[model samples]
Target chain A: EDQVTQSPEALRLQEGESSSLNCSYTVSGLRGLFWYRQDPGKGPEFLFTLYSAGEEKEKERLKATLTKKESFLHITAPKPEDSATYLCAVQAYHSGGGADGLTFGKGTHLIIQP
Target chain B: GAGVSQTPSNKVTEKGKYVELRCDPISGHTALYWYRQSLGQGPEFLIYFQGTGAADDSGLPNDRFFAVRPEGSVSTLKIQRTERGDSAVYLCASSLDSNNEQFFGPGTRLTVL
Candidate 1:
């Protein structure tokens, strides 16, 4: 079974503080790794998709880096509005050889205070 | 373009009752997925469809949870004999194909009393 684990279950940071959230995973054959941002009572919003080791993607103040066994979501100079839960998911190549559903972690609750 | 949309933003049901949640995927999207997210947790995969047929249903918890995507567009998830343990936010997502990014809907918050 594919599994994902995220660290710092809950994090609190002041505005402009930068930090990185961690996501570790173990899959039979990784097809894709994704990062999403979710707010209270809202669905997750897509962030980045890293396909291989050493791959990275950036959007605004968030940068996602991928390794063979884990992925990292780095937030730089975050603002109050950046507060949200960060989710990590992985899709593995299945017997069908097509796209399969994702296996997600518990997520990291990030609170950015102004 | 409009993202995925789910109906009945919230649903309240009693144990042993049946409920149905709907999802309308993005136009031209051929792949749709269903997930469940409990309190303080990330979304858990339930099922996914490719076109009008279910491509995978391994993540479904049991036979009580079933979904259908007919006409290759709109989909509905049906729950039978709902239980308190079934209470969670049901999320729907869509993608262009097998190797594309999935866009998620706002989700339907289900409360089984």
Candidate 2:
């Protein structure tokens, strides 16, 4: 079975603190890994997509790195505005094209205190 | 261009009632998806549509749930005989293609009384 797990369910950090969130997965065929940031009452915003091991992507204060069995979202000097639930999902390639749906992780709730 | 948009930001319906939520994907997007998220939980995939055809409906929980994207643009999710367990936020997303990054809508918060 394909499963995605995210550790540190909840994290509280002071403004300007640096931290990392983890996402581990077990899938038949890993096609792509995605990261999203969701604010209260709003939909998730796309952050990054990592397709292969040893790949990394960055935006602003966030950086995403991928490995064979897991991925990491590293936050550098995170501000209060960076506080949100970070979601991780994996796409498993099926017979036709790619997998239709994404298997999502439980998400890591991040709170940045100013 | 504008991002994905959903209608009825919030809806409160009684148990056993039927409800429909709407989604307007970004213009020119070829792939649309539906997901359900309970409080404090991750969004669970419900369905995906490629153009006017449903590419995959395997994630749908049961026959009570149905979705359509007749014109390959806007989509709607219908739930029959709603139960308390059905109360959650329904999210809609769209992408240029199945493998591309998805742009999500604000989502509809449904409450069953």
Candidate 3:
């Protein structure tokens, strides 16, 4: 089975502080990796999609990088509004058995104190 | 344009009762998905529909769970003989195509006591 593991189950940071969250995965063949931010009782909001190793994407203070075995979400100078649970998911290259659903990690909860 | 939307934001029902959750996908999105999420966990895929046909239903836990997307616009998820273990937030998502990113709805929080 395809599996995804995220490190640092929870994190606390002060305003303007920087930190990085890790997501490791094992899939048969990688089609894409995705990052999403979710607030309490709400759906996950899309962040970035990294398709290959050495590729990086950024949005505001959030940056996402991909590697063969893992992905990293780097938060730079974060603010209180940035506090949310970050999720990582992977879609395999072939929809084996015709199941194209994504496999997601447990997610990392982030709290930013102003 | 509106994003994916789910009805009955919160549903509290007694055990063994049947419930139906609805999903309205974004305009022009042909691919739809259903997932269930428990507290402190990420969403787990339940099913996927392409247009009016269910391309994949492998994630459905059992035969008691069923979904339909008639006319290829709105979909409904039906659960029978609900058990306490079935309580969770049911999420609905949609993508432009199988290869696009899936955008999610707010989710329907279900509680079976």
Candidate 4:
């Protein structure tokens, strides 16, 4: 069965602190891995998509790296505004089965205390 | 341009009733999706539509949950015999063609009493 597990269920970081969140997965065929940031009462905003192992993507103060068994979302000098639930999702490559929706992890609740 | 949009924003319904939540995908998007998220958990996939056809509906928990996309641009998720457990945020998202990143809507918070 394809499953995604995100560790460190909750993290409290002081402003300007650097930290990383983890997403480990077991999938039949790895298609793509996605990261999203969701704020309270708002929809998740797309962060990055990594398609292959050793691939990495960055946006502003956030960087995402992927591996064969796991992925990491590294935050650099995060500010209070950067506090939000970071979500990780995986999409399996199901050939001839049409489009597949994402299998999401429980998400990591991040808090940046100022 | 506007992102994905969902109607009502909030819905309060009683148990055993029927409710419909709507979603309007981004313009020209060929893929639309529905997800249900309970408090403190990640969003769970409910259905996926490619154009006007349902390519994946296996994520739907039960037969009481149904979704339709007649024109391929707009979709609706209907729940029959609603239960208290059905209370959650119904999120709608769309992608260029399912191989791209999805843009999500603010979602509709459904409350079952």
Using DockQ as the measure, which candidate wins? 1
The digit string of per-residue lDDT tens for model 4 on A1-114 reads: 789999899999999999999999999888899999999999999999999999999999999999999999999999999999999999987566554799999999999999
Tell me the lDDT of model 4 at B52.
Answer: 97
Evaluate all candidate structures by whole-model CA lDDT and list the values in order.
0.95, 0.94, 0.94, 0.94
How many residue pairs clash in model 1?
A: 0
lDDT string for model 4 (B1-113, tens) is 99999998999999999999999999999999999999999999999999999898889999999999998889999999999999999999999998899999999999999
What's the CA error at residue A25 for candidate 4, in Å?
0.5
TM-score of chain A of 1: 0.98
How does model 3 score by TM-score? 0.97
Runs off by more than 4 Å, candidate 1? none
- TM-score (chain B) for candidate 4 is 0.99
Q: Which docking band does candidate 1 fall into?
A: high
Q: How large is the C-alpha RMSD of every model relative to the true structure?
A: 0.7, 0.9, 1.2, 0.9
Instruction: Assess each model's interface with DockQ, reporting 2 decimals per model.
Output: 0.89, 0.84, 0.73, 0.87
For candidate 1, the iRMS in Å is 0.7
Indicate the worst ten consecutive residues by lDDT in candidate 3 chain B.
B93-102
Worst 10 residues of 4 chain A by lDDT: A92-101
lDDT score, candidate 1, position A95: 87
* lDDT score for residue B55 of model 3: 88
B1-113, model 2: which lDDT tens digit per residue? 89999999999999999999999999999999999999999999999999999999988999999999999999999999999999999999999989888889999999999
**Per-residue C-alpha lDDT of model 3 across residues B1-113, encoded as one tens digit per residue:** 89999999999999999999999999999999999999999999899898999988989999999999998989999999999999999999999987889999999999999
Let me know the DockQ for model 1: 0.89
